[model samples]
Target chain A: MTTWMRLMSNDGRIVFGRVENSYLHEYESLHAPVPTGAVLSLRTLTPVAPCAPGKVVALWNNFHALAAKLEKPVPEHPLFLLKPAESVIGSQQPIRRPAHYAGKIVFEGELGIVIGKRCSNASLDEAEAAIFGYTIVNDVTAAGLLNENPHFPQWCRAKGFDTFCCIGPAIVSGFDWRSARVVTKLDGVERQNYPLDDMVFTPAQQVSLISRDMTLEPGDVIACGTSLGVGSIGDGATVEVSIDGIGALVNTLAVSSGEAEAAAAVEGAA
Target chain B: MTTWMRLMSNDGRIVFGRVENSYLHEYESLHAPVPTGAVLSLRTLTPVAPCAPGKVVALWNNFHALAAKLEKPVPEHPLFLLKPAESVIGSQQPIRRPAHYAGKIVFEGELGIVIGKRCSNASLDEAEAAIFGYTIVNDVTAAGLLNENPHFPQWCRAKGFDTFCCIGPAIVSGFDWRSARVVTKLDGVERQNYPLDDMVFTPAQQVSLISRDMTLEPGDVIACGTSLGVGSIGDGATVEVSIDGIGALVNTLAVSSGEAEAAAAVEGAA
Candidate 1:
């Protein structure tokens, strides 16, 4: 398997590279990665999300284990939501709590499928061919805002805050996902450990099914739904979502002073 | 007041220009439009969406008339959904029906707020200053797919299809939305006639309130929700969403032969 990464060089230029040992061998592009012979130590560069997605489509409940736990039947299709690109942040970036919302913030770790080509109404085989690689995603959300209004479910708003979607480290191509597992930890304590095979719809099925609903562009990411052990996070808590083939995606919840002050005010009022 | 438009020149170059009587005066950029002394006839160029939005945030039940008609209370916060950038299409572009599903596709005509600068946690006054212009939008949706699953409301999937969001004609700066009315016509017959003043949240208020939820980038669009009349359009039907200050955005529904064949197959199976 090949591991690809995107990072900022010491000279402050964003470049794509192949990760090996302690060095990142520079490459021209993700689709056509021809080595540029400019090798840099991995420590000298800052890693970013392996791909810059035009859009991020996230599944709601695509895992059989989760569906069974919730007592919901298997969905006929992939139920999904579109998260704004503005909500994306690279791994190691802070997941900032919205100052205006003094509510419970949660962390959900899931496997993210990175699309390499433009896809629309693609067949299952075409969808399989379109999958470029895989990465880890921490779909951060403001849990309290989800069901606040009974009339409409605020899926986008509850999860579309800045720094809410964390993706990164590297994108691993040709990696076997069926036998791998997604392991999530909070402050060194293992919170979630689920097999990727528990997914109701495989990555290819998701790509094909979702492509019929909307066009999936190059660098677009489809985050497979999370299973059990989804829970809230406290301020300054660190979250790490790891898949064995793809490296871990680590992020910390950063509750700003303004948010803390607002929370205090709301608590005082209450 | 300035009317800005984007178009594909006959020479096959994408150009931004100011719309005058029957001509387009070319400009260098949308943010700082420096005239290029190249004037082209309006009929010579093909018009596209006035601005390429990074993301489109659309409201729901934001109109008093619609809220009262549906017997729902006015929301404390804006109920919004994010439409992917790929779904955006210009006026005169055909709205293609998804081939996999034969569902009731509805049209919603609403006022669109174009953002001029990156805004986050903005005050009401700052939000007012950040408003670059207004435009007309036909927020198209597959109404039948909205609540297909009783548990999950597929707002994004139902409305995020390719060419589902039509925006354009021109972006008019300094337009008076309060005194304006959105007028929609389906195949030359008027259907929707609603006052913009009946909105629960004004443009500035929407910007300020939503910025608190997520960062609003330059060229981001906020679509004020539609009111009263909303109905599905048949294949090949023409739709025109118009506001007084912004020109009318007209498009026709183009159902592909593949969709017709699939519909027939489903009917035959039934």
Candidate 2:
């Protein structure tokens, strides 16, 4: 299995790299990965969110175990949601809670499929070929906001907040996901431990089906829906999303102060 | 009113321009506009989507008329969804029907708010200040897919296909949106004609509330949702989404052949 990552070098330049042992061999782009021979110690570089995805497509209720637990009927097609690219944050980044939202922040550990090529209306074979690698995703959601309004369910707003999507550490290609498992650790306690095979739709099926609905561009992530053990994370708590072959993605939750202050802080830090 | 547009110049480059009568005076950028003396006939330039938005934050049931018609409660906050940037197509582009979806395609005409600044948890005043201009959005959806799965509502997939979002012709600033109306035409017959004042959440309120959930970046669009006349478009049907101040966005629907063929064709064409 090959591991890939995008990291900020000691010189402060963001570059793609193929991780081997404790060294990072730099590459120009993820699409056509070829090492540039600019090697660095993994400790010397800061890991950023690996993929600059055009969009992060997340599934809902695509897990057989979750459906059974919720007592809901299995869906024929993959029901999904789009989390804005702005919601994505790398491992070690703080998951800033929206200042206006005073709700339960839930951590959902998911296996993410990274699309390697532009795929639309693709067959299962083509879809399988399009899979670049796999990564771990913490699909964070404001639980209170989901059903606050009786008229309409606020799925997007409840989950599309900034820093709501925590992904990375590395993308692992050629990993056997069938026997793999997703484990979510909240504040050092194992909260979720589910088999990847519990998914109602397999990775190939998801990629093919979703590609038919929309164009899956290079680097776009399709988060295979989470199973059980989905629970809330308190403010200042640590959440870790882990898939064995693909390393763990860890983030801390922090409630924002307010409008001007948080906005000013985000901009200032940028 | 100042009309802004992104048009394909004679040199095949997409550039921003200020529209005045039949002429387009080129601008350096939309945020801080400066005329660049590169004037061309509006007829000579091909109008593309007005903005390259990071995300299209679209509302659902935000119109009072629609809520009343459906006997649904008026939402206190704007219930929204994110349409990927890939779905966006410029005026006159064809809306490609997904190969796997043999469903009804519907046209939703709505007023689109184009944001001018990066805003997070913004106040009404700050939201109002961030409003760059107004445009028309054709929030297209695969109507049949919306409720095919009983367990989950397919909002994102139903509306996120490539070329599902059609917007542009122009973005008009300093216009009276309160008095304006959205008019949708399918095959030259007007189907939807609803007043803009029927919105449950005003543009300012939507911006402010939505910004609290996620940052609204410059050029990002907020589709205010549709009212009474939302219906389906057949294969090869022409649909037009229009607003008085923000011109019209016209598109044609075409059914895809199949998976391998369509995927190969898309890749070849690209």
Candidate 3:
């Protein structure tokens, strides 16, 4: 089933369902449930790419397993990483793997926190107030590059390929973390599953730690690290990364020429 | 004299001098020659910290004499370096030189660009439109940090100290660069001066070259590298870096208070 979001009016007077299109709610229309119509019919279908984060400051590997794979102990401090801003995609969108990435592409399912408030050096107690909500992230990894040469410099060129990261659905404002779960699938085969509580580091600590170095700006994204169930998607494969409390984001791998053409044409014309 | 900004309003008229009182801009009455007032007149100046960029991409040895000092050929493309956002400071700010920074600190004066748009692989022709305006930047350098120690990471721990980079009194939207000059002074003695055209890499090329691999976001910053004639400010000295068409940024070097207690209190109170 395709998943969408609902939110209460700021005054908490009414519930609005089948809100804005895509999942990240920027503009939404309040509507009652329709007996049988696509979520598009809910409104004019003002769809959007997922939360267009101002910047995606990711952690290299906040997960213990990822640490073990890299032959390191849990970090004394959280590592800083970056994925380009253009990487986010919403539900039903394809994961458009770039041909340059070819065999190196892999998927990492992660729980991402969406910052609602500007926060810096936020304490564990102040963390909740700073978090506007949480969303699911497919922290797609380019293992082929790592497999080719595990080094720091290659990551930007590797992980920053146009569609390497896809985040989706509206943020669930108050997700219960204790038993939250994440699952990744390729063509309906479940490849990974783990309870959120299983993480060596907690979300509270993640916020508290990251705030130490950089002031977390509003709309700055923080992607929780992924589990080990990562693999390359064969050409033309359909992939889905889902979180239990929220929703699933399904995407296909393919080349994207039209957008580049559009940008080129726009530039040329301008 | 305190510097103030003048920006075009939505109606296409010039609006000038809004005191940034803690994030809220309180509109002021005058435009010409910045007004003078006691620090107490404004409730609290919005800590206009130097706009710490997500990245500090610098060009290496772009200056002629500096190129000779390093015994390296001036690069065909701008050689970029990264500075953590922690290093930036705002108007009237003080830069603390920790004892840990073993070498003498020198000042590099350059034209600073405050990005107002996000562009990837942007052409040189599109550089100006991507800028909100231009400001003065003191690209403070730590000779001890990386000078002879080639293994040490450039700028990160050295130039990326708290308050190392300072920008502004105002962001001048339209400033001529063709016949401009930049100068750096320590106390009453002029240390460095060079015509704007002396630089090996032009600002337009700097934007276009760096945008090839990475994205430049709105509010991101770039400090055009300083020219030759850098001299010693040594210990316990005050330095002023300025451009002919723009204003000057003066700062004194001292030690910092760790700020951990302040951060902790701010966190607890956030």
Candidate 4:
């Protein structure tokens, strides 16, 4: 007999899905290697950042559409960036941009790859071993700094605020790439949707390409570029990013914790 | 009594004043703090790097003169950066720019601060406990991609290659910054020479500023800014960055290791 955890019902029987009017850890099971006819529940949580001590490496735009928008050549290699770990929030947390930012907050829906091991000049085969799991990340942005400083040598300060990067739930290992689907929903309407395999560089290739220049340590998460349907999102909009096999991550819009607490109090009243 | 090390003659007698050229280790001591009024000599081959391994954090133009050269704002707060550790080289090496690099090498002389303790969100006084000592670094950079891209974000490919970052000697705990100085010489031409106290932010202040946003780990190195009289050197030139109290760090200029090796062979023949 195998032991699996599931949410419970009022009568004490195990519940296979979400419980009504409460927070209960609900889950389903599946075969490791599925046949074409096998069906699995889409209840897995959105992937959160796995790094505890590792630096957050963010890529600008390794996508074809974004490249076309900028009229720049798609890079032969991934352009790397550093976002200090201080900027991360959980999966269901509100994406916050303080009044000081005053810039538009844009969302870039990306497939986040979590590193499982320490690596330097790693090979493609070695990179596979280092991948702990995968998740979806809404790579939030301030969206106006690029235009403000055309001559700046680096952009760490502009992109590095306390809540610039958000990730969550747990990591899902054994993530297969073929036919994976990703969708972004805004206020209950689907805004962007695309296939995971549409990327110019695959996850394995990104790892191999990046390790040539920088050494990747354990718990490092690399966010592959978002697909088409990416546009700016203003304040006060609920943004949910979902993957086919993985569950949906719905986070509301709020400027600060004060606003979030006020909204929570209103929900309790109703 | 404490047993200390000093450079010794081939016959085992202690060598004084000048370090025997033949006895210098093959590896370079790229960036290391110099003890005030002490001649630094390696008694044992200890590997030294410009910054510690947690991440090579650099502050862009913590001094005003550098911000003007790049035509950037003297940042309201300290500007921080990550230079890949792979770029490090020892003192005996020359800064290398290969044919592949194609005239992309630039030099930045910074006072290197070595962290001895783990600290995060540290206050001004807390920063003092985190610092182990200081060193000097010639932050050698590759400019083509960085100049071509929106911002050269890849310090690994641009500045993190082998031998690109240099340091030296051993760590010395105490030095009065009020009277400290830094000097840079290219082909012995003396391009930059300035007092360390002339920095826009002090070493303790830089550490304190970073800790407010980051949890600095041990072995993490910080490169404080270079002074005025900065310029480029490559193809073939000897570059030296020296700090008063710290020993002189000398490296010949080529674009990279292959070029450095070829230059070395040519110099060997002469």
Candidate 5:
């Protein structure tokens, strides 16, 4: 398995490269591995989200373990949601809570399939080939927003805020994801630990089925739905979503004081 | 009301301009009007979607009339869903049916709020200032996908196909939306006729509240949810969504042959 990452180097140059033994071997492109002969220490660079996605298509209940645990029937097709591209953040970015929303925020750890090619109406084999790599995703949600009104669940609003989606560490290719497991930790305490083998739909099947619904372009991400052990996070708590082969994505949660104050001032004026 | 539109001129150039008296006055940017001294006949240009949005935040039950009609309670907050940017299409673009989905597709005609600036945690007045203009939206949905699996409603999948969202004709600024009405017709037969004043939340309130949920960027669209008379569209049927101030957005629905054949072949092979 090879690890790919986008990072800002010591010289302030943003580059895409491969990580090997804590050193980065800069590459010209992810599609064609033409080495740029620029090797730098990984510690000398600041990591960013591996790829800039145009859109993130996230799943809701594509896990067998979660379905059985919830006593819900397995879905015939993937139940998915769209997380706006603006919500995306890198590994170390803080998950800023909405100023107007004071509610329980939860972290969902799942594997993200990064599309490498423009895929439309692709067959199973073709879909398999279209997958470039996998990365860790922290699909943070304002849990209280889901049942606040009861008339309708605000899936997009509950999850679409800026910095709600924390993804990265690195995108790893050629990894055997079937054996991988998602282990989530909050404040250094283990919470969710689920196996990828318990998925209702395989990665290839998901790619093929979803591609039929919409075109999946290069850098587009498909977040495989999370399993059980999902729980809430308090302000100032550090959450880390880890996968064995992919690596760990760590982010801190906090309420924005400046924005909150600005909102309150506006409210008072009105 | 001031109308803004993007059109392809007879000289084979796509230009963003002000639409006045069946003539196009070309402008460099949407924020400021810097006339390029190029005025072309409106008939010489093909009209496109008014603005290029990064994301379209669409509402579900923000209409009082429809909620009351459906026997549902009014939402405390705007219950919204996201339509991926890839789903967006200009007026007159055909709504291509998903190859794998052989189901009912319905159209929800509503007013679209276009954002002018990057706004978050804005007050009512700030939100009002952030609104650039209004347009018409045909929020098309794959109706059958909603309840095919009873566990979770596939809102994103139901509406996330390419060309599912038809928006445009023009973005009319400084329009009196309170007296405005959305009139939808299928095959030239009137179907839905609803008043914008029947909305649970006003445009400014929706902007203020939704901005608190997430940052509304320039050119971002928030579809003010639809009212009653949402129904299905037959294959090869022409559907139109019209607002009184903004022009009508018309599109045709058709089944995709090549993609469907490819999917069927894969199914047969499996």
Candidate 6:
């Protein structure tokens, strides 16, 4: 198994690298990475999301445990929504509260499947082959915005604010997700502990089924929806989503501020 | 007023140009385009979508006539969904039927707001300044897939098929949209004729309000939702979405084929 990460050097150069013990061996690019043989300490580099996905195809009610609890039947196909690229943020980034929304903000810990090849209407084999690696995703949402109007469910707007989709630490290739478990902690207290084997649709099945609806491109992410433990996070509270094979992704909710000032803060950080 | 278009030359060179009467004046780029002094006949170039957007922020029930007809209240804020970039197709491109879904495909003729400046939580004045131009759009949908499940509404999936979001002909700058009308023709028969002035939210209001939800990047598109007549299209039927200032965007629905084969054909064309 190999682990890959994207990071910024102290000089502000973005580079992809293969993670080793305590160092990152640099690479030229993520698609066809070539080793530069220059190793850097992990402590000296600032980590970013492993990949820049064009869109994040996130599933809903895909876990058997979550479905049973919510009284929802197992869906025949993957029920999903598209999160915009603007919602993405790296681990250790702040999950800012939207300026206009003063409602509760929730965090869902999920396993993200990273696409390595462009695919549409792919077969089971092709779908499995298209799977590049796996990463951790904190699908943060403005809980109140969803179902605010009885006529329409605002899925995209509720979950698509800046820094709402947190992904990182590393993308692990050939990780055994079937035997792994996702553990989420809020303020260092365990809130969610679920097994990945309980997923109704496997990662390959998700890719194959969803490809029939829309094309999945290279670097596009499919967040395999969360299970069991989803709860609200208060301002300045820290949330960490971790998997055994993949590393932990930690982020803190920023203090609520006016909409314009919050937007400017995020832009300034970008 | 100026009109801009992106096209493929006979030699397969992609260029952005200013549209004149039956000719194109080449430019260096879409953002900060500098005239290249190369003129080409319109007949020699193949037109593509005016701009490649990272995400298409689409509004729902934003038209006053549509809400009044359906007996739904005018939403306080823009009720919207995100259309993936993969779903975008330029004018003249074929709208292929999804392989897995054998259902009614509907066409929605609407106006599109193209953003030139990056903005989030912008003021109304800032929003107006950020608007780059306007174009015509056919927000196509798989009518049956929507509300397929009683619990979850598949807005993104039903409306996000490959080639579902058809845009362009040209992006018109400084066009008078308030006095214009969106006229949609189905196989030479007029089906929709809605005045742009009936919109519940103006273009600037849309930009400013949506900016609070997520950042609008340059080339990002906000498809103003359709009104009045939205109907299904049969195989090989032509659909044209036209505005007075923005030229007509014409497309044809391709005959249904196997999902894998259809996807392969699209990839082959790409």
Q: Which stretches of candidate 1 lie over 4 Å from their true place?
A: A259-270, B259-270
**lDDT tens string, model 4, B1-270?**
111112334555432222344243222222232333444445444433433455677776777666677676666556666765555666776665543456557777778887867776677788987887776788877766564555345544576655677875434457565587778888888888877766778888888877654557666778887768767776777888887766677877754566668789999999
Q: Fnat of the models, one by one?
A: 0.91, 0.92, 0.03, 0.24, 0.85, 0.91
The TM-score leader among the candidates is 1
Distance from true location, Cα of A261 in model 6, Å = 11
Higher lDDT: candidate 1 or 4? 1
lDDT of 2 by residue, B103-163 (tens): 6789999899999989998999999999999999999998898888776778888888889
Residue A68 error, candidate 2, Å: 1.3
Error of 4 at A201 (Å): 2.7
**Which is the leading candidate under DockQ?**
1
DockQ of 4: 0.17
Query: In order, what DockQ does each candidate have?
Result: 0.83, 0.72, 0.14, 0.17, 0.65, 0.80
Off by over 4 Å in 5: A9-14, A21-44, A255-270, B9-13, B31-44, B258-270
Q: Between 4 and 5, whose lDDT is larger?
A: 5
Best by lDDT: 6
| Residue lDDT tens for model 4, A32-112 | 211234222323323233334356667766777767777777877777666656566656777666544566767767677
- Candidate 2 lDDT tens digits, A7-50: 88777889888999999888878888777878888898899998
TM, every model:
0.95, 0.92, 0.63, 0.67, 0.91, 0.94
Deviation of model 1 at B210, angstroms: 1.0
Better of 1 and 2 by DockQ: 1
lDDT of 1 at B129: 89
Residue B43: error of model 5 in Å? 4.6
Q: What lDDT does model 1 reach?
A: 0.91
Better of 2 and 5 by DockQ: 2
Per-residue lDDT tens digits for candidate 5, residues B15-43, read: 88888898989988676658999888888
Which 10-residue window in model 2 chain A sums to the lowest lDDT?
A254-263
Provide C-alpha RMSD values for all models, in order: 3.2, 5.3, 9.7, 10.1, 4.7, 4.9
